[model samples]
Target: MKKNLLWLVVFCFSISAFGQAPKHTFKLGESDFLLDGKPFQIISGELHYPRVPKEAWRERMKMAKAMGLNTIGTYVFWNLHEPQKGKFDFSGNNNIAEFVKIAQQEGLWVILRPSPYVCAEWEFGGYPYWLQNEKGLVVRSTEKQYLEEYKKYIIEVGKQLAPLQINHGGNIIMVQVENEYGSYAADKNYLDINRKMFIEAGFDGLLYTCDPAADVKDGHLAGLLPAVNGIDNPAKIRKLVNENHDGKGPYFIAEWYPAWFDWWGTAHHTVPAEQYTKKLDSVLAAGISINMYMFHGGTTRDFMNGANYKDISPYEPQTSSYDYDAPLNEAGNATEKFRQFRSVIEKHLPAGQSLPAIPAAKPSMAIAPFKLNEQVALFNMLPQAVKNATPLTFEDLKQDYGYVLYRTTIKGGKQGELQLKQLRDYAIIFINQKRAGILDRRLNQNTLSLTLPEGDVQLDIFVENMGRVNFGKYLLENKKGITEQVTFAGTEVKNWSMYGFPFKNINSYTTKPSAIQGNGPTLQKGTFKINTVADTYLDMTDWGKGVVWVNGHNLGKYWAIGPQQTLYIPKEWLKKGNNDVAVLELLKNDQQILKAIDQPILNTLKKINVE
Candidate 1:
């Protein structure tokens, strides 16, 4: 009874605004959105709930409302909500219903983009990693298994959100079909089924599909409203949309990219404020409905960060701070571009309409450098081994995030190209628990030549899921670790033991007195006292690349080779007393410490090309 009570309390607070379903009437016309026989142009801004802290959801919404936005668009991350198959989570910030309720309460409409395959550079394009394990399963296709799972997921989402839609007296005005489908494939059967499933799941309001202006022909489906993305020239965009869909109007630019997202080692992307204002002016003058792709781009945080891979480039994993170089900076602070865009928005409002005053920026403070004195080793906290003669994928072991260690006794050590077939991302190769060399999939550096001492050599290869490919055809094969057999001297050594170090129980890491002297990954722990708790950015300048957890909350990843070197630690996670801080440093295992900085270091462009 006590456990059940705890579960309910957690569920309720996580999605704090969850409530009873109510109904209204919302419909779509050829030229405009109608709210009870009136023309309504949806001026929206996209903001993912998972990316923002749950406690600040209302504040962000208020900011959006203040910025002249009538709608808040978001995508439902499948893996974030349902990490494991069969089991589902609609709790806390994961709860779209709660998020929508907050939007509604803030006098903002909702544009729910529940893309099961949301390729917003998210891991596996928002598909759960477990789906890869399903036998002969093909996602974003007409495959029965894929559809079945998609059906279950969409239906579950609908049960929670359909009632809250504007048609049902709630704030949600539009429901997006499979996100940007035109870019992925052009399967009418697949889209037809998707439309059927969404309705069956109970989304009885306006349903539409969005795609890049070029891909509209391939991705747009019949019986669904089609919208073009990223294009600013309203006339050209509409021309492109209509040429593909027989010229339907009341134009909507689904994802207007004011700026782009950041990847590790790349300079933070930004477009001049003048560029955005010019495009936005033309768009509003043409009377087009628009949703800024990310009016407020928040942090992706942790392993949830996704990657991009096309045959044209290397595997590019996104940085933790999704700042997007958007008008709203990483810390949710406004920039010069914000004011410029606000002026443009003010000019476009209807004769009698006006925007609310922009909210004041949130406060931040700097903390004195704190030392990470305690040490915890990964080797000490691993769970029981998933013994296997060969190797296994992350999905095969039913694991999602964190590092995986493949241990084996390399007999009569030989020197040659130690190759890993399709190594998912990055690997730290160790011979007898010491660093040998690194193998990264991004640079096509898959094999490392090593000189091994000839006794019974204990070979351990530690692989990090740099992040799964969220976009492109390579997504089908994003299984981490030495996926196939490791070859030494072009021979397959059989009968090896594999350890699954998924770090499922991160809190259980072994803490003991140790002469921490290895270059391998080290867990540095520390404690800091705080008389008052508030939001802070864990400055990663003093330390190297690693993940940080404060008071047991996974703050996210940090790399020295970064455009993003600070992780946002929300006040909700901090305490009034001493707060525990842990760092899992993978690059340099120096006994370094961290401090809290008032500002985030998001755009420190390191010029060394990652590829």
Candidate 2:
């Protein structure tokens, strides 16, 4: 009881020192944002709660406060909250309400971007994969089934966070309606439905919509404030906001990109601090509100990283590490850009006031290489196969993510081109239990030469859902695995057996590794002891393509196709004793050893299969 009293005392003291009243008002005025009826300039930074672990949310917020930011911006991912239909999870790292309350305790207000359709390079644009099962459901539209699911999700979010709004004695100052709807379509009716949903969910604070500069006019609602994204020109920002927002003057850059995200085959993107700090200074000089798209881009853990595709570009899957080269690195350590931006922001602070002290960098360690002695072949542990006349997609099998195997027998002596119609993503072909080429959707690889033997040969096509396209027009039909038929020698192959490997229970299948062998997917296990635990990167430089699990915590996917060579393992997932490591390598593993390195190799590249 005494501990509770002391904790309350510290919380009240922090709130008082931050000049936060129990109740406050935030609204858009004719020429400025009125906080307590006074002109207020929002100095904010973006940090997604799902990206960072729950244990480290407060430290990341402290980093934001130390960087002279007065506000925190976050996007609530629909998929992360509701992985299944009618079932929701707001606990653990998914606890966005706790995230916002922590921001308040850390002396920062919040700009909640709780749009159902968030395109942050997240899987399926933050839409739950189960939505694909809802036939005739068109996302970002006023479609009945889509809206019904959306309303349920948003109301749950509202129940968790709406009461936390600044008007309700909480810290959320503004809420975004829809995310970049103008870039997708020009339907105000669709956006209005989203607005009504937010309002009905009890989000009565200042409502706004954010879109790119070119799409600002198409996306913003007439009754709500419209915030421009991507552009930082002080004059153009004011001009665009005034033109679209009824000659108003509370100019805000909702997504000021200091750097860009990295795709699988591309080089890591970085923008020099000198390049954007100047623009940041100018934006602040004009007294415009700004939210740095990512003050700290944390790791996109698990299989949740997204992909991108359009009419012009090939299917490009995002790298697992979301270290956006921001002021803070993926581990929440301050970068040189952080210091440079802090210097620029210090000049704009009220006289005699100073930012909080920058926190010390988190400690990281390196572990000696360890061998994965035990192994289990994927084929040896296949679940009961579902038989079908034609190959089925991931959704058809009720599988959300991971790999699926399509097996059948093809007559011999007919060696010709083998093809998979509408291959969702990556696939590995095997004939008579021997590896026979690969097919990658990113490279539009669908056909390969096949040489059948004398007898009827067993055919196996293992397909993996690398990730769903989270942006552009192609996202509408992103059904993973073999979406269509398989043909050999121009004849449709039939009588297939489908096996799903969602890997939900990695331990159930891997508790006792076997002496399995073959050129198929293999689950390998390794163990290492640590004197102390800290943040580290599992070096996958020697491995091929697959996922890694440290103490059963998935570190996301890694491939030899260049760019991302290491998987980040947070210290919170580590302990001070023996830790188990598992790897599910799909292609090849010549060396059965792995390393826990201290540094990241995000920019390294191997031979990329695609042009």
Candidate 3:
């Protein structure tokens, strides 16, 4: 009997210690979130995986935890995952599941927001560029084509994340359906479809929809929880959630903005940390859950940055640096705001619990000035031209992003007002290999005078797809390059030779040595060495508008037009020895010497002639 009893005690202890792990249940309650039947408050911060390097995800999450945040939020970019239809990339920086796993490892819960149409200033509102080629397709709606494509992508995401939910023994507690849909349109049917898709994709956890406080009624579905964004009044947030959620509770403030994103020509948006601490304190004191929009706004690298356009606001393309002046700066350093917010959060922490120590800032260094003297003209490296009677848009030619050159032979006898009908963004026109003038869509100026010579001249119009609109009704018609026809002297110019410069691989062209001549787009190349690799910023003060690449990695676009004058170079992309550098300068560059500095110059602005 004694031997049997001893085995029984050991067996009971084993069952308590290492038997099947108990499943956690997270659900919305009358006035609070219940975790395993106990009321829980989520203190979350938003950090995008694509924006931050995958190598730095764990460090950023550590920073968030040190700031007293218990949860981490992120938007899984669709375009980043599936740049082309039927092709998916989930490796390296695109490994979102790894990001979530890191958050869980840091003892932080995750709020999975794998919305199909996330408008986080991403390219095309996170819709793959190939969607434009689909006929009669409407995104963020009940269009059959859109729904079919969205289902495939979302289901794939579910396969990766569904098993990680709280009930399945992971830290993911909630999954958001659609991102700010009510701000775009009031399509209840479309929102419903999105909800069903998430459920069918094996997302059996609690689901929610987030929108501006005013548009919650339009975006919120019947069964899911309604989360308010933008506004942060304790009473107002509670009232909005109650009103939309059938007078129930468990209110969530999805996106409480501490600062705003900066556009190319505008001033960097900054919000004083002290200005919002009072509101943040009141919200937490009232026992409401909150998620800061950007605890650390990382870089919007490459050509992935989006633009803003509407009837009231002029066309404004967002800067590549997505440093939203949050608690953690773009380089992931804790700022004064970080200290202020931590003090405020300390006041709300439970007894006997304290925030973790803030992690040390990453190392940074400055490099001596370097020169890019080797030159090659952009026209010398054109791909095989696609002959078309009419000019083709970036989408029509099956080319997404980058520049497209439209060339045609025109009679030189008559010269009048030359106009490009509905030019997508920016264009530089040349006549017989000589520059004529430039037209910018941002200023809504597309007409310029042309002087035709005696004989037939090659008229080339170089158009750049600056960025696609990420929000509002304008996103539906957002296509790159010439969307319509080009006219010289009010006459339609036909029989065009279109050349697409996707620049997916420029190694072949950048190596072909050719002497630079005239004031046309040129490719400049050089090399530099660093003793120790560290995060730095490339100063673009003297260069004209163009894209820059280091060691073959695209560093994104840089223009002389004010606001952003430097490009951030993450340490992960740099090496200790020699590094190859190249720049595709769109305009003329008087001086091609560049320098790497330790700090970012995000506020510097230059005078632009839009006239």
* Maximum-lDDT candidate: 2
Cα lDDT tens digits, model 3, 1-611, are: 99999999986774443222337889899999999999999999999998887888888999998999999999989988888898988888888888888998999999989988888888888888999899999888788999999999998888778778887778899999999988988988888888899989978789999999879988888888999999888899889999988899898999999898988877778899989999889999999999998998888876898988999977888888888998999988899989888988999998899998988888889889987768877787788999999999999888878899999999897779988988989899988877788988888888999778888989999998888999999889898888888887888989999998888765766544456776678888988999898999998877778888888878878887757788888898899889988898877644678798999888877875422
Worst 10 residues of 1 by lDDT: 14-23
| Candidate 3 Cα lDDT to native | 0.87
Candidate order by lDDT, decreasing, is 2, 3, 1
lDDT tens readout by residue for model 2, 1-611: 99999999998885653335448888888978999999899999999998898999999999998999999999999998999898899998899989999998999999999998889999999999989899999888888999999999999999898888887789999999999989999998888888999999989888999999999989988988889999999999999999997888799999999998998878889889999989999999999999998898898876888999988889999999999998999999999999999999999997798988999998999999887888888888889999999998999898988999999998897789999999989999998878888998888899999888988899999999988999878768889999989999999999999999998756777535456567888888879989998999998887889999888777888988768899989999999889988899988744588888999898987884321
Identify the leading candidate in terms of TM-score: 2
Once fitted onto the true fold, the runs of candidate 3 whose alpha carbons sit more than 4 angstroms away are 1-23, 512-514, 608-611
Off by over 4 Å in 1: 1-24, 244-246, 605-611
Residue 489 accuracy (lDDT) in model 3: 82
Q: Please write out the lDDT profile of model 1 over residues 1-611, one tens digit for every residue.
A: 99999999886663444343344556666666676777778788889998888888898888787777888899989997788998999997788789988888889888888869898878888999999889988888888898899988988888888878775568888899898888888998888888889889878778999999888888888767788897889778778766765566667899999988989988878888897798888888887889997888888865888998888898898888888877777667778888888888889888899888887887777778888777766655565778787877777788888888888887755687788887877888888888888787767888888888889988878888888888777767778777887888797755656566555545777565565765677887888998877678887865666788888767778877788878888776777889888789876776476789878888775433211
After superposition, the stretches of candidate 2 with alpha carbons farther than 4 Å from their true spots are: 1-22, 511-514, 608-611
